[model samples]
Target: MTDYRAAVQDMNFLLHDVFQVSQDWATMPELAEMMDADTARAILDEAAKLTETLIAPNARQADEQGISFKDGEVTTPDGYKEQFAQLAQGGWVGVTANPEFGGMGLPKTLSAQYEEMMCAADISFSLYSGLTAGAIMTLDLHASQELKETYLPRMAAGEWTGTMCLTEPHCGTDLGILRTKAEPQADGSFALTGTKIFITGGEHDLVDNIVHLVLAKLPDAPAGTKGISLFLVPKFLVNEDGSLGERNPVVAGSVEHKMGIHASATCVLNFDGAKGWLVGEPNRGLAAMFTMMNYERLGVGIQGLGAAARSYGTALEYALDRRQGRGAKATQEPQAEADPLIVHGDIRRMLLTMKAFVEGGRAFSTYVGQQLDRAKYAATEQDRADAEALVQLLTPVAKAFMTDTGLEATIAGQQILGGHGYVREWGQEQWVRDCRIAQIYEGTNGIQALDLLGRKVAGSRGELLKPLLREMTEFLQADAGQWSAEYQQLADAVKSLTEVTEAVLAQVPSDENIINSVAVEYLNLVGYVVYGYLWLRIARVAEAQDALGEFASSKVKTAKFYFAKLLPRIHSLRPSIEAGSKELFSHELNEF
Candidate 1:
C-alpha cells in the first residue's frame, strides 16, 4: 500500500495562525464555551493517527477486493466494518454535530481539516461519515423537533449511517422530472415507491441501519420540483423507542462497479412502498435537500483538496527518494551515480504545481469553512446574513475549482511517478479516478458553473457579489510587504471579475445562454482570484514567522511560482467570457 500521513503541521498553521479560529470560537456562543485551539488541535492529532494507521491500509486492499452484491445485501470489504466501528467510537463521525446530540460541536473550520485528512488517508471509507453528517445537518436544520429527538442522537453516534437519495434513472440535476411517489397513509407516514440511482452508502454492513433521505413527489402535489417532498426512510424500521423493528422495503438493486472508491457502496436503491416519515413538509423537498447538498458540496471540495494533498505527498516522497536524473546545479550527493528526481526542472515544476494547488486549495477551503461556521453560528442576524451570502456566492467555486485542480494535481503526480503512478500498487492512478467523481457528482462542474454565473451572480444582479467583494478588498488591504506584486494581481483579477460579472448580468435578460457560454470561465476566474488571495495570506503569515526557516522560505517561493505560472491563466479566461454566446449558439447540432 502507498504510504499516507496527515498534514497536521500545515493544518494547525492554518487553524491557529492563518485563520486564527480561536478568535472566532471565542466570539461565537455556539462554540466559545466548549472549543479552543488546544482542544481542536488535540482532535486533529488523534484524527491523524486513526486516519494514517487504520483507515488508509484498507484503501488499496478494498479496491482489489471490491464490493459484492448477494441477493439484496451489499457487503463492504474486509476491515471496513471494524475500522468504521473504530471511527464511530473515536467520535470523528460527529466532530461538528451538536454536543447535545453527542457531537463535539466544534466549528466547521476544524472539522473541515479532519475531513481533508480522512480523504487523504482513504476517501472510500470516509464517505460513510461524510454523507451521514450531511444528513444530520439537514435534520438539524429542517426536520421537526420530534424527528430530531428520534434520530439525531443515534445518527450522531454513528449507530445508524445515512444516505441521500435524489437522482432517478430519468433525472439527475433536473429533479422536476422525478417519478418517485410518496403516498400519504392514515398513520401520518408515507409509502414511497421509486428507483433512485447513484446513492452513496445506500447499503452497507458497517452500520446497524442506514437512514435514507429520499426526495419523492406526493400525490395531489403541484407538478415539477415544487411537488417534491423529503422523507426519512430507514433501511430498517425504527420503533418508537428507537430500536430496530423490521426491515423497511428498501433494497439495494445492485452496487455500481465504478472507476474508483471501490469500497464505498454506491448502490442503485429501490424503494417499494417503503415506510418513511416526512422531513420538512410536503412539496418542499427540493429546498430541504439543498440544505444537505450545500453542506455536501463543501465536503466534495475537501475531497478534491484531500486528493491533491495526498498525491503531492506521494510525489514529493518519490521525487526525493527516486534517483534517476542528474542535477542542474551541484549535486548534494557528489559521490552518487545520479541525483534524485528533484534535480530536474520539469519534475520540480510538477511538484510545485501540486504544492501550489494543494496549499492554495487548503487555504481557500478553510476560508469557506469559516464562512459556513459564521453563517450557522454567528451571534447576530446581520453577521449570519453576511456570512450566508458569502457562502452562497462561493459554494459553486469551492465545488468546481477544488475538484478540477484536484484532478489536475493527481495527473501531475502520476506524471512525476512515470509508469509507477498508473499501476495499482503505487496508488496515484486511484487518486485520479476518485477525484474525477467530485467534478461530476453533486451537480456536475457544468451545472456548478451555471449555478455560479447564473443563479448566484446573475440571478441576484450583483447583490450577492458584494459580500465577497467587500471581504476580498479587506484581505487585500490588510496585506504587509511580503507579497505586494501578487496583492496587486489579486486586486486586478477581482476588478476584472467585477467588470465581467456586471457585463454578463446586464446581458443576461437579452441572452439566456450567455451564462452557459461563459460560466465555466467565469467560475474559473473567481476561483483563480480566490486562490491568489489565499496564497497571499499564507505568504504574509510565513514572512512574519521567518524564523521557521526553510518551511517559510518554501511557502514564499511557491507563492511566487503561483503568481508567475497559475494566476496568469485568468487573463486567458477573460477573452473567452467576453466572447459571449453568439458564436456558441450559431453552431447547429451537426456543424462539426
Candidate 2:
C-alpha cells in the first residue's frame, strides 16, 4: 500500500495554495464559519486513514472474489460490509450533503478532495457511497418536500444507499428512444414499469434500504426527452411516520459480471408496477436527472484521476526497488549487479509524466469544485452566472480529459512495471481494468467530446469560451516575466485552438456531421492545451516561492516536457476538425 498521508498533503497544496478554496468558502456566509482549513484538513486525515487502512487492503481480494449472486441475493466480498458500517458510522457518505437531511454540510470543494482519496484507495468500495452522494444531490434539488423529509435524512445518514436508474436495455445515451412507462394511479403515486441496466450499487447488503431515482415516461407525456419524468422508488417504502413499510415492486433481476470493479454490483433492475412518487413535476424528469448525471460525470472523471494516482504510486515504488540498467551518470557503484530502475531516463520520463498529470488533475478538480461552490453560494448574481458558465464549460473537460489522461498514465505506470504489470498479483493490471470504465461510463469520452465542441464552443457562438479564455490569458500574463517561454507556448496553443474552434463552428452550422466527425480529436486538442496551461501555472507558483527541491524542480521540468512534447498535439487536431463531415457521413449502411 502507498502512503496516503502524502496524498493528503498534495491535496492540501492544491486546495489552499493553488486554488485557495478556503478563501472562496469563507466568502459565503452560510459556509464561511462552518468550514475552515483546519476542519477540512482533519476530515481529510481521517478519510485517508480509513481508506488506506481499511478499504484499500481489500481491493485486490474483492476483485478476485467478485460479487456472488445466489437466488436474487447479491453478496459482496467479506469485510466490505463491516468496512461499510465503519464508513457510515464515520459520516463519510454525507460529507457534502445538505444539513437539513442530517448531513454534515461540508463544501463540495473539500468533499471532492476526500472523494478522490477514497477512490484512489479503493474505487470498487467507493462506488457504494459515491452513488448515494450523487443521488442525494439530485433529490435535494428536485425531490418533493415530503420525499426529501422522508428519504434524504436516512440516505444521508447512510442507513440507506442510492442508485440512479437511467440507462435501459434499449437506450444508454439516446433517452428519446426509451420505452419505460409510469402510469398515474387513483392515489398520488404512479406505477413504474421498466427495465434499467448497468445500475451501480443497485442491490447490496451494505445498507438497510436502497433508493432509486428512476427516469420514466408518463402515458400522456410528449415524445423524446421532453416526456421523461423522475421518480423516487425505494426498496422499502416509507410509511407516514417515516418507518420502513412494505417492499416496492422494484427488484434486481440479475447482477453483471464486468471487466473490472467487480465488488461494486451492477444490476439489471426490473420494475413491475413499482409504486413510485414523482420527484419533480411531470414531463420534467430529464431535467431533474441532469442534476445527478452532471454530478456523477465529474465524479467519474475523478475516479480516473484516483486510479491513475494509485497506479503511479505503486509503479514508482516498484521502480525504486526493482534492479535494472545502470544510471545515465554512472558512479563507482557500477561494480554492483545492477542499478534501480529509477536511474534510467525513460523510467524518469514515465514517472514525471504521471506526476505532472496527477498534480495537474488535482488542481483542475479543485478548480472545478471551487466553481461549483461559487455557483451555489456566491453572493452576487453575476458571480453566480460566471461560476455556472465555467462549470458548464469545464464539466465535460473534467470528465473526458481527466479520464483520458488517467488511462494513459495508468498504462504508462503498467509499462514501467514491465512483465510484472501483466500478472494479477502485482495489481497493476487491476488498475488498468478499473480505470477503463471511467472512459465508457458517465457518457463515453466520445460523447463528452461532442458535448464540448457542440454545446460549449459552437452552441452559443463561443460565449462560454470568452470567460475561460480570459481566465487562462490573465493567469499567463500575470507571470509572463518569469516563465515567459512556457507561458507563451501555452498562449499560442490556446490561440490556435480558439481559432480552430471558430473555424469549425463557422462550418458546423451548415454541416451537423462535422461535430461527430471531429469531436474526439477536438477534445484531445483542448485537453492538452488546458493541461499545458495548468503546468505553466504550477511552474510559476514553484518559481515564485524559490522552491528548488525535488518537488519544485520536477514541476519545472514537467512543464518543459509538457510544452515541448504535449502541446504540439494540438496542431494535429486542427485539420481533423476542419475536414468537414463528408467522409464519416459518406459511409454506406451495407459497407459494414
lDDT of each: 0.89, 0.86
425-525 per-residue lDDT for model 2 (tens digits) = 77888888999999999899999998888888888788888888888888876738756787778788878888887888888758868888888888888
Candidate 2 minimal-lDDT segment of 10 residues: 1-10
Query: Where is model 1 more than 4 Å wrong at Cα?
Result: 329-334, 478-482
- Once fitted onto the true fold, the runs of candidate 2 whose alpha carbons sit more than 4 angstroms away are 1-6, 329-332, 546-549, 586-592
Which tens-of-lDDT digit does each residue in 363-469 have in candidate 1? 88889999999988888999999999999989999999999999999999999999899887888999999898999999999899999988988889888987778
Worst 10 residues of 1 by lDDT: 325-334
Candidate 2: residue 537 lDDT (0-100)? 72
Question: Looking at candidate 2, what is the lDDT of residue 294?
Answer: 72
